[model samples]
Target: MAEFLSLAEAVRRTLRDGDTVAFEGFTHLIPHAAAHETIRQGIKDLALIRMTPDIIYDQMIGMGLARKVVFSYAGNPGVGLLRRMRDAIENAYPRAIDTVEHSHSAMAQAYEAGAAGLPLAVFRGYKGADLPKVNPDIRFVTCPFTGEQLAAVPAHRPDVTVIHAQKASRKGDVLIEGIIGVQKEAALAAKRVLVTVEEVVPDFRGLHPNLCILPHWTIDAIAVVPGGAHPSYTHGYYARDNKAYLEWDGISADREAFAAWMRDNVLTVGPEIFAERVKGL
Candidate 1:
């Protein structure tokens, strides 16, 4: 049986002070809202893993909620540079330990290995690359039968995975559009999986069987909240909150503005307050 919890309760229950959390979403869609709630609750020393670290990760790092971030890339999508993340990389006390730069496919492969209880997965994307410099954990191995070298990427089994989706069944079958391999891999790789959905349907039969990305067994908790993505967006539903992203981008560029925004929006405010602030945008 799948448990149904409110977003706040789910986040409060699953997150610890220091844990590795993989977030679902691309550059600007379906960010894990409950993960942000956890960050705002003062969870410290979090290691956030993502394909690309964008506004949410940047803000968390700036506010001192993140200790490390493992990602393939970190930048403002379609915008300029991610000023806050760049500054933190260059400055900030107790600098962040960033990891190897690999494609999303490679990261998903690593998570799949972790989910399968494997030590490592070897491939050929690191022979002459600089990823080893960023993450020395990767090892090169020789295939005895094939007599070829392969890059050994260790599994990234996270403590938890927080994913936002379009819809879910009452029984916890997640329905998401488009590519879901990464989300599925993250759910399987994590010890616990929490999903925030825009809405809840009655049963799995209502959804197209082919669009069923995650089965009920993999999900630990489900929270139904419309507009759960906030700054992000749901595919085939709405566009991203461009105005909100612009505000975040502006605040992220300047220290004082960013500090004020964090104190006003993140540290002092709860989920309700944050939602209210994003109402117009």
Candidate 2:
């Protein structure tokens, strides 16, 4: 059964140093607050997994909280390269991080395979791509049936998978609307699941169908955290903070400035302030 808990307690109880963690949510509901909490708690050496690596993963890598990153495309979305990520990989400033590159389909299939309790994700990808030259995990397998070449990668079964959603019922069921990505699959594949939601209502009365709903049994803990997905939009609750993303390029350019900004804005602050982001609620 899912228990209602504070974000601090949830992160403390669910995550640990050197664990494989996946803070998943493609474009929307990016779980920014949870990532900040992970940094504040000082969790280190995590193997972070996600399809599209964005600002949150960049922050974790910048803080040296991650040892390895497994993803397809990595960037600041519409912006340029993730400066801190680039620094870690190129300059090895904070630390030299390892990377496992894959295509979008490969990662998505890996999540599905993990959820299905499979050891490998076999798919058709990486044809004429140079990723295989760098990542040995991208192996070639011949299908016994058709003899067609298929790529195989290890399943991404994270120790814990964290995601942000719009609402949760008091009964502990979570509701996710707008852009649904690999959240449900990741949660199912993980050993433990942590969800942060904007609000907890008595019942999901007016919510539309076709939305991703995780029953209480599937969730370990649920945190009521409005604006938890800052800098990323949470569908009807808020809009993406374009200025923040743009400003991050400058703030994270230098190591000292990045540490200073995180110390002042993120470390000093808590999830309570995030509620202010969704006014008139």
Candidate 3:
């Protein structure tokens, strides 16, 4: 059963140093609040896993929490590069983190393989793709049945998985309604799952048809946190805070500016500040 806990408690209890953690959401319902709590707790040496490493991972990486990052595409959505990540990779500012890059298809298949408890994800991909040369983790396997070469990547079985959802019933079943991504696979593949939601209602009985519902049995913790997906948006709750994204380009541009921004915005604030993020919507 999923136990309802505070954001701080959930993050502290669920994550540890050197753990592989996945915070997943496609474009919406990204778990920014949970990521913030992880940063505030000062967890370190994480192998961060995400299909797209956006501002959330950028902030974590900027804090020097990550030792390695595995992802497909990494950048601020609609913005240019992730400046903090660039600083870490290019200049070794704060810390130098190792990166494992893969194709979008490879990542998707890897998550599926993880969810299936498989050792490696195999799919017909990377044909004429040079990613294998640069990423040693990417390998080719010949199918015995078909005699066709296919790409393979190790499954992503994270130590912990965190995601933001639109709502959850008092029973702790999560409801996510929007551009559904691999959050489901990521959560199922992890040893532990923490779901932060905008609100917890009596029951999500009426919100069933279109909403992707994860039964409480699949999750370990539930936290009620409005606007948990800040800079990123929730489907029905608020519009994307494009202003924050644009502003972050400036805030994360320089080392001093990024540190100042983290101190002022993330390190000092609690979960309550999340509600203030989308006041108008």
Question: Top TM-score: which candidate number?
Answer: 3
Residue range 89-179, candidate 3, lDDT tens digits: 9989789999999988888889899999998999988889888889999999999999999888999899999999988898888888889
In Å, residue 86's CA in model 2 sits off its true spot by: 1.1
Off by over 4 Å in 2: 278-281
Candidate 2's residue-wise lDDT over 25-70, tens digit each?
A: 9889999899999999999999999999988888888998888999
TM-score per candidate, chains pooled: 0.90, 0.96, 0.98
What overall lDDT goes with each candidate model?
0.75, 0.91, 0.91
Clashing pairs in 3: none
Candidate 3: segments with Cα more than 4 A from true spot: none
Let me know the TM-score candidate 3 reaches against the reference structure: 0.98
- Candidate 3 accuracy as lDDT: 0.91
Q: Which pairs of residues have clashing backbones in candidate 1?
A: none
Q: Which numbered prediction scores highest in lDDT against the true structure?
A: 3
* Native-referenced Cα lDDT, model 1: 0.75
Clashes of each: 0, 0, 0
